[model samples]
Structures are given as C-alpha cells and as structure tokens.
Target: MLRKKTLEILTLREGSWAIESAADDLEIAQKAALQFLGKPGVMGVRVLKESVGDIGNPAPGDILFEKLRSTGGADRIAVGEPSSLAPVCEDIEDLFHGGGRTTVNRLFRAYLDKNTVTATEVMHNAREMKRIMDFESMLPSAISKVAQMQSRSEDSPTMGERQNTLFGFADRLNKRAKQAESLDLPSLANVEINEAIHQINKKSNGEAPGYLFRVAASRELINVRNWWGKFAMSVDWAGACKSDPALANLDWFISDALSNASVLQDLLGDQDSLADALISLIEIADGVRSIDTEKAQDATSTEATAAKINGLFKASKLPESKLAVMERVCRQLQGSGALTKDGAEEPKVFREMLLRLIPGTELTGGPEMAEAITHRQSHIINKGGEGGLKAATASVLPALRDPGRKAGYLLSLIESDLGKDLLKDEIEQHLNGLFMTPESVHQIVRTGAPNKKMEKITSIFYRIQKSNLPDSRKAQLTQHLDELLASYVVDGKILDRLDDPNKPLHIRAFMLVSMCQPEMLPDGKASKLAREIIVKHLRRPNFETELVAQVPDEAKKEKILRDFHVQLHRSGFFN
Candidate 1:
C-alpha cells in the first residue's frame, strides 16, 4: 500500500503538466504533492509515483514524501519538472529524515507529556536508528557517497568488492541478530559464533566453536569457563616477536593455549578455579587467532632463520678489530641470557650467537635427546664460529640449569653438548619456569669436554656390562648389558646387543635396529635416528602394535620392525 501510494505521486508529479485547469490543479498538486518532493538521490526525498494522501483528485496523488531532501540523482529524476519540483521538494524534506510530520505528530504529542527514554521508546529508537543506517547503505547514491567519504585506498580499484562484502556481512549480521533476538537472547552475543555445526556438519567433519573463553577463573557451569590454570612455564621465546608487545602476548597465548593445565582443568570438571586469571591470555590468543596463521608462521620462520644466521657467523674475512667489536655487541645482545642473542646481520656478530645454539641433546639421558643432537644438529653448518663460540660460552648457564631446553636449544646446531651448566639457583629458576622440577626435569645427556665423552660412555657401559657376566660372569654380564646400553655405538659392536631386555626400558626399548648398524651409524655414534626420536613421545598416550602399523612407510610399507623387536625380546631371544 505504501509503495503504491509512492508510485502514484512520482508519476503524477512528473506528468502533472498534462492536467486540465492548470492553475487550480497545480494548487491542489502543490498541497498534496509535498510528500515526494525533497532531496535528489535514490533514497533521498522526492516525488516517487503518487500519494495515498490524494483524495478525490483527477490524477493519482500529487506528492510522494520522504524524510530527506532530494539530492540530484535518481530521486532528482523523480523531481524532473523543476517548476513543480522546487517548493514541494523543499518543504517535505523532513519526511524522509524523520521530521515525522506526516504520521509522527500523533506520537510526538504522546512523548511530549513523558519525555524520558522509556523501554518502548528505547526499543523504538534502536529500531529506527538501525533501519536508517541500513536504509542508507541499501541506496546506490548513499553507498557511493559513503565510498567517497572513505579515505581513497590503494585498493580503490576493488572498492566495490570490498564495499559489497562489508555491506553484505553487515546485512547478514543484522538479519541474524534480529532472528536471534526474537528467539530469546541477551544484549551481548558471541559475534564470532560459527554456523558450521548448525548447517554444514553432516557434509563436513567440523564442530562449532565457542566464541569467547571467559577471562577470569570462575567455577561456572561444567561445560563452560574451563580455560584456567594453564601457565606457560618454560618457553624459549627466542624466535618470538618480543619487541612488539604482541610477541610477548602471543608467547603467553601459545604457552597457555597449549598448556595441558587448561584442558586438564576442564576435564577434571572444575574450571571455576583461578580461571579468571586466564582472561588476558585468552584475549591475547583470540587476537592471535584473528591474524592469519600463515603470516604468523612466516614470522616464526623468519626468526628461526635469524637464529641460524647467527650460528653461521665466523671470523672469516672481516678485520680483527671488527671481530672484537662484534663480540662485545653479541654479549650486549643477550637479555639475562633468556634468549639466544640479538639480531645480528654481520657474519662475525651472528657467528657468536650461532655457536651458543649448538646441538646440546646429549645433556640428557633420554635416547631421543641424544638422537636429536645427532640428526638435528648435524645439518647445521658451523659457519659462524663467533656466534657459535659465544653461544658456547653462555651454554654454561643453561647447561648447568635444565640441560634439556638448553640441549633442545643446542640441538639446532647438530653438535654435541659443550659443557653448558647453570648454577643451582639458575637451574631451579629455569626448571620451575618450564613447569617441571629439577627432579622431573632430568639433566640433559651432554658433555662439553668432547674429549672425555668416549671415556665416560665406555666406563659407564663397561661398569654396566661387568655386572651381568653370566653367574660369576653374571655380574660381568650385567655390567656388559649396562655397558652396551650406555656405550656409544662406535664400531657397530653394539649391533650384537639390539635385543637386550634387562637394560633400562627407556634405553633398550627405545633403540632402533637400523640405528646401530655399522653402515647406518655414519657419524660414529649413529645417523638418521629412528623416525620418532623426540623425548616428548613418552608424554603422549600409548596405543597398541596394530595402531602403530597404521603409519605407512614412503613406499606404503608399514615398518613393523618395532613390533618384531618387541616380539623377539618377549620370546627371550636375547636369553
């Protein structure tokens, strides 16, 4: 009905000149046609078609009213006969813009007695504002005006696309909010709610994600408020964006997000404990999530390259004075020795930082740690002697402290432990931070004095081997077993002991047959260690042999050698 009336005014306003009794018709037209004559734009006020306001008139209603004045555009075309267009357009401009002169006078009188923004008024006003904004965005003229108002962007060529997407999102969100409001909701909403579970779940293996993780720790409902108690104890934020606040913030995010504490606390069924403490962390993680992961990953990779660049620095062709100055700079770069060193562009400077990161895996007793030192570090070319040397110097601190992260840190160099040792206090501090105690965080299997590594391994292995010598030799045999277990596989001699069961489970059980083969132990100890040589493997939940069989090899063969070894040992082949 409203649209039809608008049409009548627009047509009669444009064609009214054809009417009989021109002066008298114009007088009647002027009075009734005020509805559509205002600003000249698609959505701005103008005589549209006709007016429902017209009564007993020869033609359709004389005016179409809008709240806004006609801006020169589509609405202007609606006002073509300027003689008829001028005054009516001028006077009724407020109709399109809420002058409310037409139907508003009735409500304005009601509000005149009670002027406060009562509940009804608030709801009505909110609806009005929302509709106004939406109406403006819907109009081509208004959209163009808004686009012009925006700072001319480098991406201006794609302005239409951007505007379309942005406006489309706004439109969808507006509709969604309206639907959700009618369905019983609160003033606040989880704006980021995922619609996948509600729509695409059957077609895709996806789950709807919660929009917000409560900030403070609250023992709220069981299914909600669960992300607390997750402290990121130990992190080598060496490759982080530390300078930018976001770097530290993201570090906190990663630590807390990945922390077993967060999930475990939830699983334990009481997340109401100290969970509020995680709010800031959650917010930061949310921000990190807002960014593209690919970009974040690239930044992390850049930092890794930076660390490597430091390791590659050496005395090389640079002058000696420059070298001395570089060393001073490297020391200056360290921050309480928490990170490797500062960004080093010079070879001499970077070399000092690089040396400190040498593979320190041997610092721990675990099989994976040792293997990591071998495989991971081996690939790092020790080009930057200065950085490596400086890192070697600082290695004493962390080496003495946890030996593990230090070792983990060093493993990037593909070199053996260089006797890096942290003091007791330092060890306690570092260990506590990494969410483990000295008792739980075992010392890294490392030796700085490389010359003595062979002697110690031989001694430990021989001592272990001597204890199990078969009767009188039983002691010797026990000793031999220990020797073989600890004994660095030097000349493939350890190949004979692959099936030793009495040895420590972590040692014997973790060994790979391919590891000790003379042909495979290229570095004299071992090369290309087992596929899964990271110490964290033990921390994971366990599964059975058939499950392990699922990991197909490169040629699609599942290497069941681990199964074979376990079976051989079970069958008492060693005995």
Candidate 2:
C-alpha cells in the first residue's frame, strides 16, 4: 500500500526554524515557502515532505523530499540579556501558570511551530526541553523584549533588581528542565492518557492535564503564543478527551481567544471587503475550507458555500469554531456602512444579505445575533434611501384598507428579526390599526360578503393571536374581536338561522354548534354566547321531541341524539 504524503514549509526567524504553512501538494508548499524566504526578516526557508504513519503512532516518518535556502551574507542581529521583568516562578507548576507561561509562549513560539508540538507536549518531553535550553538566543531575546515593555511603566523596578530577578527565574527553569530530563517520562504520542495518569499515581483525570502541563514545563517552556494556536489546539485536545475534567480549562482558553479582536482578524484572513471577511470567518467556523490556497481560486458561489456550511454545522467536530465565527460576525454586522460594493446604491441588497446571514447567526449567537440584526436595520432605516424601513412601513399603510393584505403585511414583519425591538412599537401600532378600534372591527365584520367577511375576520384574529405581540396586547385585541363577533351574531341575526322552520331541526342545531367550534370562533365571549344560545334552545320544552320527531325510526332517532350530545360536549357547549 502507498503511504500518504504531506508537505510543510519552515521559516527561520532569529535562530529558530518555525513551520510557516502546510499543504498536501509539494509545489504549493514550495511556492509558499519561497514567498516566506523572500520576506525581509526571514533568515532561511525549507520544505520538508513526510510520509503519514498510522493513527496514534508517533514513530518517525520517512522524509520524501527536502530543500533549504539561507541569506548567508545578511547581517544577523546580536542577542543580548536585558534588565527585564520576568515571571517569578517558585516551582514547576508556577512556570505553567500566569505570566511565566505567557513569557515562555512569546519566546519559543517559532520553535514550537517548527516542531508541530504544543506547550503541554514540550513540558512532558525531555528531548524537547533540552532543545530549548540549547537554543542560544531564545532566552536573551525574551529578556530584551520583556525589559523594553517593563521600562515603559512608571513603577518598574531598578534595572539591577529586574535583571537579577529575571536571571534567577531562568536559572530555576533550567534546573527543572535538567531534573525532567533525568526522569523516564512516557511519550504522550501513543500513551493511553488515563492509564498513564494511573501509573503516575495521580488521583483523578482532572489532574491528568495539569500533570501533563507540569511535565512539559519541566522538559521545556511550552509556547501557546498566538490566540489562534491556543484556541485550535485546545479544541483538538478537548475533542480527544471528552470525559476528562480538565475539559473546562480548555473551554476557558477557547472562550478567551474567541473574544479577542486580533484572534478574529487572524481567522478572517485578508479579505477585500467586510462581506468577504464575514463569509470567510463563517466558513472557517463551519469547518469549510473555502479558501483555495493551492490554486488561488475565486470564491465559491454563496449558495454552494451556504449549503456546505449547513452540512458542516450539522456534523462538525469543532463546535467551538462556530462560536468564534459568530463573535466576529456579530461585531461585523453592527459595524457602520453597507455590506456590498454598491454602498447604499440598493438598500434591498442589505436586506437580502441579512436574510442569508441571519439563520447561521441565529444558530450561533441567538439573542445576540438578533440584537445585532436590529442594530443594522436601524442604520438602514435612518440612512438607507427609498428602500428603507420608512418605505416598508409606508407600504403597509396602503394595504391597511384591505384586511387580507393588511394581515399578510403585519404577519411578515412579526416573523422577521428586522421587526424586533427597532420596530416593536410600529408593529404594535399596525396591529392595533388592524383590530383594536370599534371602527376597524365594524369594517372587518360588515364590509364584505358574509362568507368573505367571516373568512377575513378569522384570518386576522388567527394572525393576531400568533403574532410576536405581548400577551396583554394580544388579549386586549382578541377581546375586542370577540366582542365584535358577538355583536355581528346578534345584529346580523345569525342565530335566527336555528329558527328556520323550513330546515330540519337537527340540521339547524348542527350548523349553530359547528359555528361554536374553537377553529371557527376561538375561546372567547363570542363562542360562549353561541353556546349559551344553543343551550337555551336545547332547554326549551319539547325541543328534543321536535328534533327526534324529524327522525322516524326509534333506533336512528336515539343515535342522532347521542351524536348531537357528543358534538355539543366537544364544542365546549356541555362543559
């Protein structure tokens, strides 16, 4: 069987070789490596091709290809020990926490990247620790950078004091590294984590991760330098150890990275516009590799990409990536200006874009995303031209004269995020115009053909009940509707249909009872009044005799009476 091959590009910065990028194709990796080599600060560049090994196995792989280049004549910057503030560490655990770990991350970021290893991995591995100690300029460079930053503060310690403290911390770190090098630590690459923890005499799995961090610290200072690296690595580890109690710590790191602006920018990459950047971030979070670095292809169609995003969201392994993407998108949506190249040329584009983005935003940010969408709508309403909120509200006014159109318009607003807080009052005002007043209710009940009028009124009431309006508002409006319906029943002499002697008595009773059903009248005073009218007629002396008189056969007459009682009970009349 042929083994799979992968290519990695490494760039030398200062004295350390750091992995710049990776690709499955050698040509693409070489091209990217050459580009990095040409950059001003890069001292050297190389591409390494390695054969894939079996999963969970950490043995060395065969190198299929290698290439190297260096700026031989370029002057190298001299390394110097500076009087800088370093994190004070009393023990190996101290080195893995707070400022000490931060300092290590900054110093050996390139080194860790070059080796494709995590800070936790370095701390536990003796060989990696010795490599850091041997990296001549890393510590000196860290000292200079920290000293420069500390010097800017007004209450910084004296240079002599700072230097002595920093050097002491370095010495302690070196001593711990030597101690770890002397121990026989198990290789993390293939060890059953739980079993390893047991063998090490750790009390719980919660201690497993911490123990690993401490071990890595002993071997070498691990660098979790970039937020992206920290977040991505934590996600990977969290997925691997789902049951581990240390998962919470990994979650914290993920949350911290997602909230950082710099980290968001890193994830968004270099896009020409806000729309592109947002789409890029969304794709990344959804686990879609939208950007084609190898061929430098144009962006995939939005429809295709959206379908891919939806599929990935359903089955994605990296759940935290979606959260990070949403945070960036929320910030972008709230930003000023239009999302397209046309600017305010056509405001409908903004609406269209919003419709497309809202589903994903809602999936990720929920209420936060709704608020962001509201904010954007406010911007468009206040500044976007003829196709803005004012125009939309105005359009609804024309439909107000037609109840069916009016109900449809109001329903549309109630169903969308655009009609949220920004338009809450407007929606309420329109709903009131549709159903609240005596004049509106009268028109709704008396304007059209009897059947059409009933249909329109029912439709309006159904929508009002289901609308996003407050419960008190819905109640008040519905009560008014019920009163209107009751008035129409009385004034239109609708119940008089039951007294039509030409129709069969049972048929008249069935029609009136059906009208009392909730679907026809809902739970309100109107339905109650209809039921009262039915009960009044049913209680009349000889009413049952008159109904049974219409059915000749005794058995058939009893069955008819029984069915009528059951219908009455179900329609809430008997109750």
Please report the candidate that would top lDDT against the real structure: 2
lDDT of 1 by residue, 1-575 (tens): 44322232232233232221112243243322331222123232223333243432434334333233333363322211111011111222222111112122122222211221111121223342254333321233333333333325564535454345434433443443343223221111222112212222233223111111111010111122223312111112212222332222223222222222323232223223222222212222222212233533563342333222222222111122122222222222331221213323223333333343332323221222222222222223232334444433344334334333343433222222221222223323432343232211112234443223333333333332322112553243323333332344433344336435455333443454335322222222232232223222333456233324444463332335455455435433344
Local distance difference test values of all predictions, in order? 0.29, 0.56
Please write out the lDDT profile of model 2 over residues 1-575, one tens digit for every residue.
98676676677778776667778887567545544543446665666655244222223343333333323344432332221234544456665544455445446555554554544445555566556544534443455455455556568675445544555555555555555555555533345544544444453244444554346322322355555555454444444543443443343344444545565665555667666676666666666644434333322333333333344444653354466467568768877756767666435555544544543102234444444554566575674643465455654344235665455555555554555545666767777766775554457555765545655576667767776667897788777887787777777777776557799988888877877766677677666777887887789999888877878899999998998888888887656
Model 2 misplaced regions, further than 4 Å: 1-387, 396-405, 408-412, 438-442, 445-448, 553-559
Best by TM-score: 2
TM-score of predicted structure 1: 0.22
Q: Give each prediction's root-mean-square deviation over alpha carbons.
A: 26.0, 20.0
Error of 1 at 238 (Å): 33
